[model samples]
Target chain A: MDKGRIFAYLITIIACTLYLLPLYTMVNVSLKSPEDLIWGPVAPARRLYFNSYLQAWEKISEPFFNSIKMTVPATLISTFLGSISGLGFYRAKFKYKDLLLFLIVLGFYVPPQAVLIPLVKFLADIGLYSTIAGLVLTHVAYGMPITTLLFKNYYESIPKEILDSAEVDGASLTTLYRSILLPLSLPGFAVVSIFQFTNIWNEFLFALVLGRGRASQLVTVAIANLKGTTLAAWNVQMAGAVIGAIPVAIFYIFATKLVIKGLMAGAIKG
Target chain B: MARYGNLQIFLFILPATVLVGIFVYAFSAWNVSISLTDWRGLVTSIRFVGLENYLKLINDPIAQKALINTFLLAVTFIPLTMLIGLITAILLCLELKGTSIFRTIFLLPLSFSFVISATMWTWMFSPEQGTINSLLRLLHLDFLCQPWITSTEQSLWCILLVYIWQFSGYVTIIYYSGIRSIPQEHIEAAEIDGASRFNIYRHIIVPQLKGETIGVLTILLFYALRVFDLVYLLTGGGPALSSEVLATYMYRMTFNQNLFAYGASIGTVIFIIALAIMIPFLLLSRRR
Candidate 1:
């Protein structure tokens, strides 16, 4: 029994160590000076330099704001659209319901790379390329399927009797959704919000290809550019990474339970 | 009775459906069209090139390398991630104290952007002053040190290691949920029947977790094929395209090399590969 306990502890420690390796490296890199970075491999600096954080801050502030602009609206729009569609699919009898649902889910499998060039061209022709609105619209379209699927599943889990009762009381669709279904499904909304937020925030390829200038560049693109141009500025790059990652990390930490529950809920339903 | 409800449903769903159809499906078709044309550098004067782009792709060395590397990376990543995930899930399911804390710690990586994760890992594998080599020296194992991200032989492996570190936690959570769904009665019955822990796991727990396993495997496989951020950040398919995956190679072809049509051809190939794998799986799961 004692041996088994030790073994379990050992496994846990190893797992935790593996998990922390990248983070540990990031912290170490963030504390080093540019001179140290160029001179050394990836070792700790002679002393911790805090100026890198400032440099990274100045370099990324615009892109950071751009990211926020893109991610927040995208998350809100996607989640709202998803919830409404999910409710529609769940509550109302629709023509070609199965086909519609399948189409929504099919969006999940379409590799973003598969449509990159044409999307770029299409958006460029419409004056949406290199614009924040364009990026948000694209994100919304991409995010809808998963978001809708999540909400639809969650709505399905709600006992049909409650919805029926609301209908019998002459509650209209909007009223019923706002007063009952929405409140009851707040947790699902929170889950979808977090997922969409993380996805939009972390998205790089589209942002890189679409958002060319500093005016619309996202944090991921900023960080990538920073890394490429400021090779010597390891600390600054790490600082940029830390700053770029902080908001999503904080969001996930706060809603970890909700996120896990949401994933399981969606998976089981699917 | 249902007239108002139907109107409401249409109103609620039409916007999202239309957007998805126009952007996703329409764009996908457009992608196919571009792949067939001689479009280059901003889609000007697109001329139908038939299967010329694809035929060129079949013989292109970089594309061949990319196809092979993508398969290799997925092959390495899926099993390794599944193994680590399964182990961690099983361990966590043992009802150990502080499991929640462990879960949180493990999940911390998933919260960070893939760019951040890849950047951090790249720093760790830095040849000169990286923590890995320092730790190795500290433990008197100096011989194992090498330039992890830059070396041809090691670049792909390094990327795979980073992926495993970042994603194993996610799969662990999935498996944990699956394990939790198993009824307690079954385990107790096996225990009462003098079945060993291994026996109960092999016979009961594994069988019960099949659905979750399938789900995780399919998701992981899809993710592996589409992997971009880590490979892009870590090596940029470096050391002479040794680490190039389909996504990265396609990006290079379009943006870096200005081979828009060829890139689209590659993207079309990727779509076909993904559909080839996913369609059967979807059908099978639907049948079940």
Candidate 2:
């Protein structure tokens, strides 16, 4: 009934429409039949159609699985490594400990271009160039800085007195972490794993240079190539993009709280 | 506890120290060395050129355009995103019904990969079959149907538009949570003093969102510096390298042309600039 409330609604509606327009076009066109192609992207699909999905799946499936094969191992290995290292940085006392952690965390901001040439050469020298394993290694290595920071931040949130008491009991490092830190770590694991999974899944540059071969190609690269392969077939291209986006999209939707938590924890100072 | 020792810390951090040390830091130093060479191809062709590439890069027209475009994108993008994000956050805090649903919808785009965004937006910006031009025609506004990515003039701005679309929602989310976290006492007290809502916000609320703005700007500046995929896929820095930023142009020089040293120089430029901006910010965060 008020003037400002009406304006607020109008603003919200306009913003949402702009955000959703491209998504609507992609979905609408991907579901159109060849005969319905004449209607253009402005219209909704004339009828339900699934052939584009099938065709797109056929082209992108192998690389989709390749993404999975690489991302899963990289996420697990990186998160596990980051946890212990986070604990190390949290508990360690040394002359240059802060300086060392500062250097490690600073790597998170290094432009990938700065490391690309040598990463490719390093992988090639080890005979792992253009391999899925090489990509997994790249992801894990790149994944270290943030994962360590996130878990270190997470572990620090556990009160010092709780860990102090555990230390008073004569428990060793491994035992304290096993019995105490791991249980308290479930939320941290959720946030860190989601962060790593979405990052590695969506990554393009590393996959482009390091995993260009068919045997190790990532889904992002495949979807990009799908455009060139099906150059005129907009339907197949949109469908392939939808498929490429599904995993990360699902994570953002279903685990939004954790995703935002990860984004904040990764980017902002805690 | 001292029994745990420095050895314990080093042992626990071994994997990260080694992996990040070699993969991130050492590789960066190696990249810097390669920039000092003229190793276009063949291992035997390698020769130390020593800043030849940097001198040439300074003179290069395309690199100059890219530097200008980067400054253009950053100068436009950062402020616009923050302004829009701040406004959206304020509107969401108005406590209308179903605000959570609106928040969720706004964030949906952030989930998409740039590859997906490129694919989708390329379709949306297609000259003949695009959503914008088509919708324009439907409204009988054919005069407004301008060439988007194909026109050299429009190409850079189009990339800027997409960058804003993908990122503003992220800034909004950070700001929304930030606004919610501000204690209610100040606003309540301001209202009791007969201050208008706008005045209350202008004087009391906006000033306190500094941390959120800094955090959001750090992320946005990083994207502005390293943006490649969308520009690479959407326009391929095309219509005469009109939309070329340093990343895509550097990629082409190195990978496509095999001008390894030239590209390495460009990469170093990006890295050095990033460090210059980021180091102070990192120190600030550490001090906090």
Top model number, TM-score: 2
What are the candidates' individual DockQ scores?
Answer: 0.60, 0.73
- Which DockQ-derived CAPRI band holds candidate 1? medium
Q: Residues B1-288, candidate 1, lDDT per residue (tens digit)?
A: 333557888888887789889877888888888899887885567789899999999998988998999999888899999988888998899878889988888778877777788777766787777778767777788998888888999999999988888878878999988888899999999999999888998999988887887778767866886888889888999988889889999999899989898899998998888878777777677665
Return the clash pairs for model 2, or none: none
lDDT of 1 at B74: 88
Scored by lDDT, model 2 comes in at 0.87
Q: Recovered native contacts in candidate 2, as a fraction?
A: 0.70
Candidate 2: stretches off by over 4 Å: A228-232
DockQ, candidate no. 1: 0.60
What TM-score does model 2 achieve against the real structure? 0.97
| TM-score of chain B, candidates 1 onward in order | 0.95, 0.95
Clashes of each: 4, 0
Off by over 4 Å in 1: A33-48, A265-269, B3-5
